[model samples]
Target: MKPVFFLREALRALKRNAIPSFAAMATVLVTVLVLGVFIPVVQATTGAANEVRGKVIADVYLKTDAQQKDVDRVERVLKSEPMIKSVEFISKDAAYKTERERNPKAYELLGSNPLPDTFRITPGNPDDIAKIKDALAPEAAGGGRTVIDPAIDEVRNREEDTNKILAVTGVVKITMALLAGLLGVASMLLIANTIRLSLYARRREVEVMKLVGATDWFIRWPFVLEGVIVGLVGGVLAIALLAVVKIAVVDPLAADFALIAAPDTIDFPLLIGLLLVAAVAVSSLGSGLSLRKFLRV
Candidate 1:
């Protein structure tokens, strides 16, 4: 059959069953709208969580009398570790200058620069902080304090603070992921049910066509086209609504909130395209599958 014939039949069916058609379209619209909003929210939240994780770092303080060679060796070892992302060395002079700038009166009483040279260690993953600290200062054979390198004075990673941040961020990410999965499933079911209802209303027509020797493809094309039409209209409407929200709400707030302005979030045009494709694909599949039982005649 010609494409025009299938499209005309689909249009005629939609007009004949306007209420069901409208209901299916409305279902698609709501699903698409929810998805459109949820995508950006998830991205922003994840980005914020990552920023917090990045703050979890380890500070390795060297002995005040440590030589340049010892400092170089420590830096080399840190850099060799697979779990360490970066190692930054700060001289005692630099540390003293920074502290004095923050509180000049506190430093005036000191006879000499008391701060030790420090190595700031950032881990590839926040959870690896304890390993990095342990690597630097493991327990001694007699259970006394010991350092992996004699030049190292102490290692601190603020374990309590790191654990808290990791726990909170982990829960947030897991919760968001689970919620997104659940929402996606619900959307699919809702759209599928709406399409099924439309198919149910036209079951008699399907049966009559089958009984009259109409090929399955011949019967399926019109219903699939009808679903495609509904999905296209619904998706376009949803995208327009999202665009208005982005312009009026998100864009205005982007200047004040780093989360909103972050470049890591999904691109708006790409997101819209994905939603449109999803809407059309789901509707057409739902229509085709829903017609299977009726086609058995």
Candidate 2:
């Protein structure tokens, strides 16, 4: 049979069973929308976590009365450690200046500069944070009271906060994946049912074709084409809706949430392509599965 014949038959079947066709398409639309929206958000969240994780560093605060020699000694020790990637010393005055710049009005209430001299230690990796901290702390590595670095009054690391963020991102990804799977299955079943109903409605036509010696493959092509059309249309609709949401809702909010450093990570073109491919696959599979019973003749 010619391609035109299959297209004509598929179009006629779609028109004859308008309700089921619409239902099937709607199911696909909802499934694709849910998948499209969350997948990008999850990706952006993960990217932000990675960016922060790369910059993870330890802050070593010094005693108020600590002098230049103390700073140099701590700096030398930090440089010697294999876990340490880089160290930058910040004087009390410089720290105070940064605070003032960050919140100009808040510092007006303070009588004197209370910020301490500090050394910011960037670790080779976030996992190496604990080792680097203990090495530079006042306590010796063996737990004896011997001070390893006298100038180090306290040590601070944001490893816990980073871990929590990563954990939450992981949970979000897993939840989205499960939800996408459920919706995908649901869409497939709905499409299959729609195709089954359409075929059943035209049982008489199929019987006539079988009597005239029409092969099963010839009988199946139109239904498969119909399924492909339904899927492609649904995917297109979902893509349009997602595009609107991205432009009106997501794009506008990205700037406002820039402080978290998570925006601009979602690749729109790639996402749309994947959604279209998934839609076609699910729809076609559903149609093929439903056609088995009707093809027995």
Residue 83's lDDT in candidate 2: 91
Superposed on all Cα atoms, model 1 deviates from the true structure by an RMSD in Å of 2.1
Clashing pairs in 2: none
Q: Largest TM-score belongs to which candidate?
A: 1
Error of 2 at 156 (Å): 9.1
lDDT of 1 by residue, 1-297 (tens): 599999999999999999999999999999999999999889889888898999999999999999999999998888998999998899999999999999898899885899999999999999888887877788678976688888999989888899999999999999999999999999999999999988998899999999999999999999999989999999999999999999999987886674433737899999999999999999988998899999998
Q: Candidate 1, TM-score vs. the true structure?
A: 0.92
TM-score of each: 0.92, 0.61
Tell me the tens digit of each residue's lDDT in model 2 across 35-90.
Answer: 78767766666566556566667798888888898888878887998998888889
Candidate 1 residue 14 Cα shift, in angstroms, is: 1.7
lDDT at position 209, candidate 1:
98
State the weakest 10-residue window (summed lDDT) of model 2: 138-147
Instruction: Quote model 2's TM-score.
Output: 0.61
Which number leads on lDDT?
A: 1
